[model samples]
Target: MDPRLLELLVCPVTRHPLSYDKAAQELVSPKARLAYPIRDGLPIMLESEARPLDAED
Candidate 1:
């Protein structure tokens, strides 16, 4: 992911800032407890496509 783009992107559900997880290729929203996937270098920011976080996450 581009550093500039990551800085601009926010969680659609909580409108909170997202953190990049390079290994997982996800943009994680701690406030929303969701992980938005990055596919083919593009972020899929939709709420429906996000994965819910577990206690460990």
Candidate 2:
């Protein structure tokens, strides 16, 4: 993803800043404990589409 876009994107639920997880190909919202998927080079920011983070995460 573009750095400009990444800088502008935030967690939809918590409104917290997102950090890109290159290995997982996700935009992680640590505060929200959610990882939004990046599909086909586009971010799926919907909460319903996010994966919940476990304790290990």
Q: What lDDT tens digits, residue by residue, belong to model 2 across residues 9-54?
A: 9999989899999999999999999999999999999999999999
What local lDDT score does residue 10 receive in model 2, on the 0 to 100 scale? 91
In model 1, how large is the Cα lDDT of residue 40?
96
lDDT leader = 2
Each candidate structure's count of clashing pairs: 0, 0
> How many pairs of residues collide in model 1?
0
lDDT of 2 at 32: 96
> Which TM-score value belongs to model 2?
0.96
- Per-residue lDDT of 1-57 in model 1, one digit per residue for the tens? 899998899999988899999999999999999999999999999999999999899
What C-alpha lDDT does candidate 2 achieve relative to the native structure? 0.96
Candidate 1, superposed: residue stretches over 4 Å from native: none
